[model samples]
Target: MDAVQGTLDELGTPLSEVTFVVFDLETTGGSAAEHAITEIGAVKVRAGEIIGEFATLVDPGGPIPPFISVLTGITDAMVIAAPRIEAVLPAFLEFIKGTTLVAHNAGFDTGFVKAACAAHGYPPPVNPVVDTVDLARRVLTRDETPNCKLGTLAKLFRSGVEPCHRALQDARATVDVLHGLIERAGSFQVHTLEELKSFVRAPTPEQQRKRHLAESVPHSPGVYLFEDERGEVLYIGKSTNLRNRVRSYFTAGETRPRIREMIGIAERVRHIVCTTGLEAEVRELRLIGQAKPRYNRRSRFPEKVVWLKLTDEPFPRLSIVRDLKDDGAAYLGPFTSGRAADDARIALHEALPLRQCTQRLTERTRRAACVLAEMGRCGAPCEGRESPADYAVHVENARRAMLSDVGPVFTALEARMERLSVEQRYEEASVDRDRLAAYVRAAARMQHLSSLTTIPQMVAASPAFDGRWEIHVIRYGRLTAAGVMPRGAHPTPFVEALVATAETVRPGPGPIHAASAEETECILRWLESPGVRLVEVDGDWALPSGGAARHKARIEHAYRGLERRRAAEGRPLR
Candidate 1:
């Protein structure tokens, strides 16, 4: 058998030529420049196979933080007799030479390595890093149980992997997780060097200038754009497979004369990828709302819709459809076209005859009714035998089926026509069932069914302190909510005006204020603060304003506004 590349025992080479160094490090603290590396562990793999491994501990220059030591089980005493990080740094770099660095969350490990190298006056590693966190999120089931940690993945694969925070053990587990993820991602073979770089990033602006590059894009749901040489937008389109759709323009096949002409002028293509189909649809709608692309047909133009109209003529005739208006009288359409609304009226009139011209009704010229009159199907209006009041009753009945909710009630009445069917009433059941479906469609028109019971006061603003402000929510006169600090300076005029507004912003019953840009910056800084409290009703926290007095004033203004708004809203006077 060919040397199976995926199972390479010592070389760490897989079937493909891609080389990866799955690695982990135990450090005295997170900052590699200030702290030091306590342990280093790694396994080398190429293609889908493993090739080699290395693991060792080094003495950190400082005492280990108690929490970290407890978590990793690496103590200062253990590293006291070990060689310093400087001694092992060269070997660790050599072990990963020419290999792409891989870690669970690669940035966390890579950042430390870069810092440590910087400390030693060495250039940071140039090798690209792959974050398994991002990969697993993209490729695996998002709701996978037991969490996506190394231990969980090892358990899921039944790899018999030992549990430890030791660098070597974690590195081995990371490799196992990578293998499991690969097996699950069907047919997507990992590529090395140049191929990997392309798969990893969207085409740069410079590379996008080249011709014959359409075939290189990956097929995924996103918004695509066609741009001219001057960088002006020529057209925009959205698709579940952007690559396939864009490439289709370049392919030789049946093409619309217009598309063929437009393709010649297109110089560049660009896209924005969305994670889900629903997200893509929403994003497409939003972009269309913003840019208003000329070539896009469906959403570009707005139209006036028409509905079925009942005119108050002498005969009170149910005429053809008309345009919708805010008139008191009810109209039944807003349909795609006027003809469709008219067709519905024709169908309704045919199903039940409310017209006196029909043979079922009595006529003025004749003394007796027509055949329908004898069958008791009409009110005998044609023969002048039935009273106008009785004739009017029939018209009212037809109107109820078309206009009132009573249509559904009568539909249920005819549904039990099956009982009549056993008594040979097939015609009655069939007619009623079809009518019920139409009534159901009509009922769907009432979609805006909400009571609007509780009104939420939403406010976004910024404090003057350090160019930051916080968005606050006041519900029923209490500080029931808050958000990220806004970005920008709280202008003196706006602050003074707002302070006045806040004083009169009596508890409860008003529009919620949105945070200003400056306040938003402050909220972001507050969120970043250690031991910050996030709670129901409020996420309020003070931002370290980098010692700016203006920023301090901004924070104060936001707190006061929040206090006043919460009170006015009757939420709680905080």
Candidate 2:
């Protein structure tokens, strides 16, 4: 496979194998629309050897300005007997056919050529234009030439002929500068004509030079890794079309600075083709978590997630923690940030008088009551004002809010926010709104994840783009195996084979067992997408009647409102 991949790469023309026509033009003035070509010169070359030379004088059908006559030795009388531009353009275009055009400051010369074609009923030449001036700027240092003017570069490169403002002389000098730049570019590993063009256009020349690394990637959906020369994964990504996505990093559309820097260091593109886009997404998340590639900002630290834990102490309090254990404590998250976990904890505290402190509490452990108790927030459990039975109610409510339902909790907060709004305390109302949103969203996610993770083993299918079925075998919320059934295939046999070969996942603790929350979330997303069907299940696959999924519309409505409010305040929505 490595041999095949190596053979399939390097799909670019080498500079030594390319034919080039180095051309220059002397015009009556700067603008092609108003000026006419007074002289045209070109040298066709291949492999550092000139194949042919073309030079001709053209009558402008107007008097030459004295300044232009002084710049070039050509006088009005010199072009009187020469061919007209209309008569000379056909042969000039033909002379440069089937070659890449090269010139100093090529835009000006090419602009004139294109204008001539448009005016004379001729098609504009489609040749790729290489500007030696641009190439010199990319390949040469300021100390090497000070400037990229044709005459200065010619002298710096020790060209045998110097540019004398005549078309043929300047063209010859530009050919030397082009050769010098190409040789200099080879030091940067830009040996191909495509690399040369990319070298000039790409923000990082290394990105263009390694473009062939994407050649071996297929057009199928998959995960791709940008690996450095040492075989270390620099960045990991996934796309529906691996080839196109990998190729896009080298194009103008990918403007992210970090990604461009990753492309510069990447030596090759390695890919794993998956059966479906969902599978690709799952693999990308898992790989990024495992590899912890420096270039991948998301999904690299799944363990760093914080959970809102309802501690099983005498007075169970809401505490934000990093690890989820097999203990009896109920957990609400998998929240990606501490601030979100804190928000959820505050929202619960607002509804129930759960203690907000970090100290461990006991049925008999008496301590000084904090301001929370004085403010009628907590039940003063630390000072033994509240009994175990009384606090148990808050503990059970917190568990219900975390695992099963959050409607009453949201209602309590909504009532508070409404009262605050009636008092014209808009800021206090907004705070309540945010805390409510945080708790509702976290509870909704927990329910969605728990619904899938509780199932031991399951087989599901969704309609594929073709007349086939996209089947997935899931175990403990992990995508153990994925396969596609052909249009007329037997479901039983196909599902049997897929299940037999599926990965074995022993159920682990927590709602997202044997997989990261992001991974399970990806699988759940696929399962909930339209047309998905549960082919078989070993256990219940139902969500609770009071689950957050039941209140999905309200959650969505709340989220949209939050987005609008934050947008008006110039803050991030999430």
Candidate 3:
């Protein structure tokens, strides 16, 4: 029986065999941010045997309050010559390296340690922590113990050492309580450390192992990155409250299979704090576009965007092209897909009589007209039946429709849809309605982007949650720099500093000249959102008078009418 038990123990997972550093800290007060550590005590154990012990008096460099001195024995006179936290932190950290840390209420002790590390310029420890109080609650019944406090659990478990409001004594008592809880936990078949943590339900076992990754993330707007062991980025995301958002991924509420797989593989979570949620969103899009991380599905393929171009020729034709050039031709899009560009193209053809042919047309060089000429849909500019002077009118109108006015397309498509609906041609009406909707949507988007891209620079501010202002500097529609302005501070200096350090954007050939369409769209949404106040602008920041704004209402009304009709007739909407 002894031999068999030895063999089983040798093969068992790590909980029974793992080393632990049970530590305690006595501080001048409760808040780690406000108080200073006065003493550190730790006991390192393995397999219920003490391997080492460390105890030190830390000179807090401040006078301890009389009440604090009364709670814990040490006073101002006792710690005056003690080593500073900076001098003792390295030794304490070295002793506890690569071991699970345990304490009665871990946050109080660990917060001070983390605060010391941050204050003294040391990286915070990523060691897994086991809180004895939490473990006791999970494993011990109310009948077994009235409370999970250190002194209460220590007495119930019959610990050899009693806590007396001193660092080393409390640490020794916590070690005993932790062992008692572990022994009780084995009755439920939780032998391994992972199983023990699972028994405690530390959020979840896998995420709990790495939940320390989110400890440093701030509770502010930011972008986050999940990276693998090789430091390769696996996912990039943004959030309004970065700490809360990152922590949510490790909880049971996160149910996405792909994300769960990502969590298992992720080793570190990195963050970039932003001045506002909008900047974080824009940065997320830009980083995803640049990194093209394996897990991010958006902003991956900017090169595939298609546009509608009105060719500059003797007899101009509307062409769907993949490239945007600064050659004085009217361009309409950064359309995501070729199919969407085609829909907009069809809508333009339905509204205007422009020649559609693969062959180029010159006034002197005439070719044969196709079926479109016979149907009177085209002016037959390719066959000399249309003069260049007359063809120029169609081309000009096409340009105006693409760049400034989508009203004609809206009016024509609406009339055609009404006629088709009256004749009971529902499918054709739906198709025409979709086509015109696509054109109006694209025109409105382009006009909105053009309003920002044409401006040389702009400064805007919005109120922050903390009674301050979040300011941004934009040059040619690209966000350059962001900063916070204190309440009641003068804006001139803050705005000037931001502008001086802002990113230098050189405008290019498209509707969104200095940034990707997604980035510009995000910026536009932020600008248009409530509470944003424009501080300064170098040029006109208004949409054109003849742009597609008027067509939006018509499209919305058409959609509502279609929904009402479908509901009445019991038809599934396309």
Candidate 4:
């Protein structure tokens, strides 16, 4: 087996290979939208060597404020003969073409340039930008510099060129500050331009001392556990490269306050190496559920997950349930919350005439009809007013609506909404629309889940970055097992291994149930990702064209429009 490479593959351009253009601008005011540029200075550098320089004073087409003139020494007379911004901007854009733009408080400088470009009717340059102030905040502490001002950084880095409120000289000072920050970042192993851009959280001295904890971790795809002094797990995470990922937690790269606190309490770093990224992800989910680590926010309360089930009875009714069993019923969730389950149930009731009562009804059973039946909302099976045969037809219709067809339900809801709108009951119409949307959303989710569950066995593969294929064996839409196959290796052996090691996950209580919603969603996301290939499928796996899936997008779009109108009118959206 080949060793799995780290997640941060050598894909991004290395820092040494990138060209940086450090620039500075002296403006008449602080607001880029309101201010005018007085002077521009830029230096183009590659691999620590200056290759080009640009400096110019621009005529603001207005008077230079005396305070600004005193500060920058760029008087109206100095720029009296200088070219206007319309002329200077184009040349400056050409000078920094195909290079990362850098400046202290980059937003201030880049904002001015972009505004100038817009005003000149020129398309703004799309080059990547780097902000030294942001970079300094990530790599330096307050003790290193009182603030992230250009003058402060110049003095801290002891740059040979001191800033004297002049554009060109300040640009030189920023160049030194950029180099100093980049060199300091090397200690954290941030050598790629991508890493430098993303580096923001500064690691404390305590975290730096614990760097050795990651040294022994393998540079392979796996899950890592952060344990406190008592050997209790504080958090669990997965990554393509165990070593690099764990090392990141001990560096400035880890930003979340909860994670920082967890790291401070973490005494040991442990790992479980996996053969493929899929397996690593699955293991991480399983571990988080099992350990319920303090820092793991999601997937920790799987037991609390609820489902909307259509009861297996003569008059099938929908109810919210917590556990799934091998009962012959149709289920629509593993909904994240009780409120969501209730919303889906209400949507179904609005479209179907199924009974809402809890009493079991037989041919001879007798009970008073509820208000729902009195209002013609239910078939009144509890009162024996509806025959078993007739109720069975309604049950079948509800079943079809939940599992196969949903057109009638949406049509009914839409007609009701239209009637309410014609009556000028806008609030009632809105409520009807919301119920309709909920039904569509739930139906779409069920359809997606149904498409997968219909398959008994499936073998899916996606190309991995390390010249291998990530193979997953899914049984009943739940990941039974997963493995990696070499680029040119035969599938027979890997397939056999996957089957032999496959876990036997019991199907949910209902025939439609597969797994927890979180796990199913994870699998769905991976299957929908780019480059996934279906190696083998034992049964049908496809979405229905005429089902509620077709109406989801249109309904969601209308819902968004309604929300915007409500927000504009300052009306509460319910």
Q: lDDT values of the candidates?
A: 0.51, 0.81, 0.81, 0.78
Cα lDDT for residue 442, candidate 1: 32
Q: For each of the candidates, give the backbone clash count.
A: 72, 0, 1, 3
Give the lDDT of residue 531 in candidate 4: 97
TM-score of 4: 0.60
Pairs clashing in candidate 4?
Answer: 324-509, 325-509, 326-509
In candidate 1 the C-alpha lDDT for residue 95 amounts to: 86
> Per-residue alpha-carbon lDDT of model 3 for 263-361, expressed as tens digits?
888999999998788789988988888787876666766567889998887877778898888888889887888788889999999989988786777
Please give the distance, in angstroms, between residue 232's alpha carbon in candidate 1 and its true position after superposition: 36
Candidate 2, position 305, lDDT: 85
CA-only RMSD, every prediction: 24.1, 20.4, 25.3, 16.5
Model 1, poorest ten-residue lDDT window? 446-455
Candidate 1 lDDT = 0.51
TM-score of each: 0.39, 0.61, 0.61, 0.60
Candidate 3 to truth, TM: 0.61
Q: In model 2, what is the error at residue 529, expressed in angstroms?
A: 1.7
Give the runs in model 3 whose Cα sits over 4 Å from its true position: 1-210, 553-574
Model 3: colliding residue pairs: 15-193
